[model samples]
Target: MERIVVVGAGQAAGWAVSTLRQEGFTGEIHVVSDENQIFYERPPLSKQVLSKEATYDSLNLFSPEQIDAFSIHLHKPDRATQIDRVSQQVTLESGKVLAYDKLLIATGSRARVPANTWKDIPNVVTLRDVQDCERLAKRLDTAQSVAIVGGGWIGLEIAATARKQGKTVDVFEYAERLCAR
Candidate 1:
């Protein structure tokens, strides 16, 4: 039987799997993700999860039952290092080669943290995924004052979550205004 490989287990990858099943593709389906955990919504990482109002469970895109029903094979805590176009194979970080008749790459972008600065700081955090949300949420819970380096949506959202928890928030934006133009 042929196999379909979907890279990056974010929202797009999750949707791709669902769409494939809904479209009547019966081939073996495989999802590759660098994250060890299962797929979850990213938006919640900055808002609900960071606010401590929601847990990782609340942001899950699909349950184990749903995944089993679709017969989707999940390869996680691993990354696709290279792709062999001629052979249609994906080489994972662990040197495992996944043969696929079709492939989908949905790896999303990451939060850009400036180098030579706050990134090395122990308390500095970025809200991009569930793990990030969990770490920052824990820090915010005991923080009396919070300083957000950016004024983008995620930063503002974090600010709001922090304030909701009764912590003072200071947002630093390089641009004249917050958010993207």
Candidate 2:
């Protein structure tokens, strides 16, 4: 039987798995992710999640029942430390190795945190995943003002949510114009 492994169980990975099954690929489908929560849309993290308009559960791309129905092997809270091309194997942080006839890497992007002391600050937050959004949401609840470093889509989204929450928001962008490419 053919075996396929997907690194990262985010939105893209979820879709890829679903599409594969839909297209009649009958084989072992394995997904490895560092996050406990899998198959969630990131767009709502800044909007609905931050504003308390949407629950955390609402961000899931596929339900637990749906995942089980798809027969997808989801290894949660697990990180793939190495990929040996010669052996066609993926080694996880937990020391388990998954042999894959095909490998798909959809790890997605992260918040580009600058090398600074900001990471040490408790109040300073970055939005990349659900946990980050949750922390920022809690902080925004009591914050009188919000200082956002980036003017990208994520930053602007957070800024918009903060404004709706009646907080003073200042957005600092690297380029002269906001969201400059």
Candidate 3:
């Protein structure tokens, strides 16, 4: 059987697995993710997820039962350290080596926090994951006024959610207009 390994556990990765199954490719499928949490919807992380309008359980893209049904082997909280394309081997941080006939690299992007920034300051946050949203939501409860540094979609979404929660929000955009990049 073909051995397939998918790096990164996100919406796209999940879809790829489903597509493979639909195509009737019966192979060994392995999914590796650095996140310990199960796959969940990303859009709601900055909106409903953070606002308590949605729960983590409700945001899951696939349930444990689904994973079992599909026979997907999930390696959580594990990061891929190196890839030997010539040999078709992937070295993980956990010292596990995965050999694959076909590989998919779906490593997602990270949040861009400015260098020399005052991230240590209280009530300052950037939303990227479920944990981030949860932490930001807690901060919002105690913050009367919040100065959001970006006017991008995430910042704007958080601003809207914060407003709905009755917190005064001031969005700071370095560009001429909001999200004018």
Candidate 4:
């Protein structure tokens, strides 16, 4: 049996696995992700999740049952540390090595952390994972105004959500206009 290893269990990886199954590539599918949660969407994190309009559970792209039905080995709380192309193997942070006939690297972008100068400031927080959303949501309840740093889609989403919550919002964009990216 052919073995296929997928690094990263985000939306892209989820879609890829479904497409492969649809295309009749019935090989072993092993998905490795850093997060413990199942395949989930990120777009809602900035808006619905933070605004308390939607729960984080609603973001799941694939349920545990669907993943199990597909015979996908989901490895969580682990990151791919190295890929030995010559050996056709991937080494994970947990010291687990997987051999694969085909590999897909769908590792998405990491949340950019603020500069060290902003570290000491308690008001400066980043929105990325579920915990961040929970923390920010609580903070928004007590905040009167907010200054968002980016003008991109995520930043815009956050600003809009904050405004909906009745908080004064000021967006700071390095670009001349909004939605630069």
Which model scores highest in TM-score? Answer: 2
- Write the residue-wise lDDT of candidate 2 on 1-181 in tens digits: 9999999988999999989989999999999999989888989888888888999899898888888878988787899999999999999999999999999999998777776787898888989887888789789989999999899888999999999989999998989898887
Model 1 TM? 0.91
- Candidates sorted on lDDT, descending: 2, 4, 1, 3
What is the TM-score of each predicted model, taking all chains together? 0.91, 0.95, 0.89, 0.89
The lDDT per prediction is 0.86, 0.90, 0.84, 0.88
The model with the greatest lDDT is 2
Please list the residue runs of candidate 4 whose C-alpha ends up more than 4 Å from where it truly belongs after superposition.
Answer: 113-122
lDDT score of residue 10 within candidate 1: 88
* RMSD to true structure for each model, in Å: 1.7, 1.3, 1.9, 2.0
Worst 10 residues of 2 by lDDT: 109-118
State the displacement of the C-alpha of residue 24, model 2, in Å, after optimal TM-score superposition. 0.9
Report lDDT (Cα) of residue 9, candidate 1: 91
List model 4 lDDT by residue over 1-181, tens digit each. 9999999988899999988888898889999998877578988999988887899889998777777777888788899999999999999999999999999999888766457778568888888677778778888999999999888999999999999989999999888899867
Q: Tell me the lDDT of candidate 3.
A: 0.84
TM-score-based ranking, best first?
A: 2, 1, 3, 4
Better of 1 and 2 by TM-score: 2
